[model samples]
Target: MIACSAELYCAADLLTRASLGELDVDIVAIVSDKPAAGELAAQHGVPFRLVDGGLAGDSRAEQEAAFAAVLDELEPDLVVLARYMRILPEAITVRWNGRMINIHHSFLPAFAGAKPYHRAHQRGVKLIGATAHYVTAELDAGPIIAQGITPVSHRDEVEDLVRKGRDVERTTLANAVRLHLEHRVLVWDNRTCVFA
Candidate 1:
């Protein structure tokens, strides 16, 4: 299953790959709080679930609980957070453990949270990268499964970094998902041993 926010960039790529029989997994459902995501899932013929507990008086805890319930109902073998902007609650993270994975916009251990491409551009970094890792409670510090980087020059602006970073993110996330599904990734001490 894929849980995402407004942008379905990763999800769209995964769906395309799956439709072409490139991905050897079944996408059970696409769950999100946005109708835009639902529309995307509909276009791909995947089941869509709208579980937004943040409607008016609902608390954050309620939203988390609703999301957890969606997972329980689906009971997916793997959960991929394809740009799911919200930070998952601790209970959900612990319950899912190694079964959940996420794609961060940076190479991780640096600019681990939001707007990583912007940070990379501001620092005049020569390389912008993406990280695919397990979703632990400690933000983006989970065991890294896959990463890809692209070279950038001083002339590259924030938009340029974002464009390059998206490409890396898509491929890296796909590789990570493939590795995990093939049972070729082992985690120890917050790191990964990928036999690839």
Candidate 2:
């Protein structure tokens, strides 16, 4: 697994699972656009690469080339975007279409991007959730693999929702990764047929 993230929670969960033999993944290396994830990788004894939004170099084509070179060097079977902040270029997305997945902090197709908990709170939603899906070029609109929700009330602040959402994200992302690795997910027409 090659996890890309600026935060440590998801990557830490994955690394811990792999260490405990709970997940059947090696977690060979970690790539991040930020240094926080690099610190986590170091703690876990995994190789770390600091790429610019998972791509390196100054120009678009050069960045793509650098991304390709990194992937080529790692030869990862799967790439997990564990709350990776930057938007990936389309070429990279297309190149690893089926082999990549991402954990979005919202239930998806609703609060698709950025500060989803805040939006959810503003809308007075009764439940906050997380979505894990294939990393298509179309943001969070990719085929959904797993979703989890936690009930919330008017009394719940944004921080409360974020806290609850993180737990959901962790579990949902892990489940999606497990399904993908176990060959239980089948994709067709931008939708997923998960056998779990």
Extract clashing residue pairs from model 1. none
Cα lDDT for residue 160, model 2? Answer: 95
Model 2 alpha-carbon drift over 4 Å, by segment:
53-65
Off by over 4 Å in 1: 53-57
> How do the residues 124-174 of candidate 1 rate in per-residue lDDT, one tens digit apiece?
899989999999998998899999999999999899899888999999999
Candidate 2 residue lDDT tens string, 142-167: 89999999999999999999999999
Q: Least lDDT summed over 10 consecutive residues: which range in candidate 1? A: 51-60
TM-score of each: 0.97, 0.92
Alpha-carbon shift of residue 105 in model 1 (angstroms): 0.3
RMSD in Å for all candidates? 1.1, 2.2
lDDT of each: 0.90, 0.85
Worst 10 residues of 2 by lDDT: 53-62
